[model samples]
Target: MWRDPGAPADSFYEIRPECTDVPKSRFRIKAGKTLSARKWHAAFSPEGYLDIGKTLSRIHRGGIHPSIRGEVWEFLLGCYDPKSTFEERDEIRQRRRTQYAEWKEECRQLFPLVGSGRFITAPVVTEDGQPIQDPLVLLENNPDGGAIVPPQTPQDNNGMGPPSTDAANKLEKMTDKGVIQWMLTLHQIGLDVIRTDRTLVFYEKKENLSKLWDILAVYARIDTDVGYCQGMSDLCSPMIILLNDEADAFWCFERLMRRLRGNFRCTDSSVGVEAQLSNLASITQVIDPKLHQHLEHLGGGDYLFAFRMLMVLFRREFSFCDSLYLWEMMWALEYDPDMFWLYEDAEETSDKSEEAKARLKSIRHYGKYERENMKNASKSSEEPPLPISVFLVASVLKEKSATLLQQARGLDDVVKILNDVNGNLDAKKACVAALKLHKKYLKKAKKP
Candidate 1:
């Protein structure tokens, strides 16, 4: 497991005053306006070829306006192909909604609270799939099959009326293991959902909180491999708030987890973030040897302190609005034209990976930062699969490199140096620094 070093998991971060500042009437404002609804409409040709290059550039430089962010995120997250025509995308969207509906219906059948605009704060089933008949839980039936899971043994059955034969048989068909695993995660999802974005007015509505729970519960049921993790609520809440439609938000969150779920995968011995931590170690060692050595001497070489930032994409470090802005910018800058294809056939191996690397040199729709990185990618000794976010985190580290080297006498100090950065970092500046550091690192990696 990745060691969570400091602060309770539920703690909130403060936002900088600049996040709420009046819009600066400057070039950036005009540049950002280029991504307005009108510009977005114009970006598509008559046949609906999205000018992804232009759109990506605009988002990277100026970030996205709130009104169009969710839509733009659909493309950025690879939910829809930019190459697809308008009609094709519309068809895909409808099909995905139907598909999501099916997934939700499946979960609703297993658990009554799904799509009920209410969520449970306690587990409704025990580890062995026996229903927890708590008055607080109030387990009910799915109209089609009725999901009151039959108690495994009579001793466990507390005078409950027998389930209808049809409901019992339907549940019997499901694997005992799958049912237990899904059932166990219900309350964890609920607990996280209520606490997620609570300080924001958007989540003050109980229905809104339940909506997030519904999306997450459905996700955990469908994605049994990763299941429900605490930080996932942080990732899902923004999607719920940004995209008004629950299914769309679910799909968007699914796409994000496609990229991020690896971080949550853990074993008794190790953590998934270790891979990125290794990459971050490499970047820091190469970029600033002195700072890296100082950290190593402080027993901070593992970079465990950065676990939260990578886990939740710096959600706690930046203000909610600024974090959203940072996400679009990072996604735009890291945008890959081949992401849709690659993600779909992710299990395919070596040959496809090589082909993708080769295509990077000539692809026209890649975002600004990725496009430039491709030119130098060959020169770099190694290219980590997910480089931008790690580099962005590295940029944040470099932002505090001096303080870290001077006063970070131990591991805790290193974490404190980072904690001080919470909410004060600038999204635009951090992104710019990451890109600069990326180019420099690429050049530095090429040797005689």
Candidate 2:
């Protein structure tokens, strides 16, 4: 994991047409600039803006519009063209499916040893103390024990008992944990495309949902102690799509799950969440201290709403294809900058102030939030580290801080503002902001 500490981190590259193959949909090219200019500057015209607006609107309406659906899906899947022959498509699908399946089995075996039942309900050490496991596989099996179990409580026989209120509260919290697990499992099963019905039910056609459930069940069996939870399905959705190969997806999800599994471990287990909230708070304070203070006053300091975004690495915000393109760009950047680091150096003596520690930490945190940590010791173990979403989020809030503080009255207002963002977001703008923040942090940390 520490092979390439000095790799130039590219998690903050600007998004342009060259990064993805999204066809000209609603966004239009401006009059003054050539396509080359637009690519170089990451610029798009007002017509382009309107198109993004339309795409987002369609998204909010519960589906990508038919006109742009193919482009959006293709882009999300990173499929530049639908020109593949039936045999080719089948081959690709089979490869992905096999990858997901094998990884799912691996994770199932490991989860039991790490989770071990009541330990999940109450734990001492995090699974991280052990070697990191495959996320795609872990994701296939539910992290929480399968099937819902109500909270357990010890009773006092001497005409006294733990307060019913306390018991109910604990049960509710436990239920939430179960819900999140379920969500991750659903996501792992590739049920992320929100349906036109507005229902969160899984698709049962051709035993698709069952396959997802089966995959999740394997994870559950590994850690039957931590069983299924709801929101977890949401976290697993992008993995299923990206891996397309079940074993690969299962392994990738398992890797992701190792870092993120703590998020829903138990009520007492909130260190991961708190760390993320702190990062968010730090960004707001560093970029716009005044707005940060105002939000803090409004109790926005808790930053609860941002939790989902952090957990899934912006999957909820961008289209799946867009998210993958953005991720691959970051990966490419990390790889390009540090291709040799894995083999050459075992350690670095650089001062923390000059090192990539914080930037690296930032990416880890964002990926943790996104639940997209890929820790496979590939042939090139020196992969560059990049966390593009942090840059994106920081840029967005920086761009809107003044307006948000001016118009909104409190923390609730801030949450509402963020939620309304829908899909009117500018990926390129966010990418630019991320780059700026990366530079800012690097400069601030430079040794005096």
Q: For each candidate, C-alpha RMSD in Å?
A: 9.8, 17.0
Q: Score candidate 2 by TM-score against the native.
A: 0.47
Error of 1 at 447 (Å): 2.8
Tens digit per residue, CA lDDT, model 1, 1-448: 3323232211122322433532221112343343667788889899987888888877776766555778999999998767668898888788889999999998888876678766655555667776655433344432232334222224222112233333333443334798789878877776576557655656656678778888898888888888888899999988987898898999999999988988988889987888999889889988988988998999888889999999999888876777788888889888887787766544532434555445433466787677777776666536444558898988988889999988988898898889998867777888899889887777686653
Worst 10 residues of 1 by lDDT: 3-12
Candidate 2's residue-wise lDDT over 336-419, tens digit each?
112212222244213224344333233322222122224332422464333455556666677778778787787668777887
Residue pairs in candidate 1 whose N, alpha carbon or C atoms collide under 3 angstroms: none
The prediction achieving the highest TM-score against the true structure is 1
* CA lDDT, every model vs. true structure: 0.74, 0.41
Model 2 residue 338 CA deviation (Å) reads 8.4
Lowest-scoring 10 consecutive residues by lDDT in candidate 2? 155-164
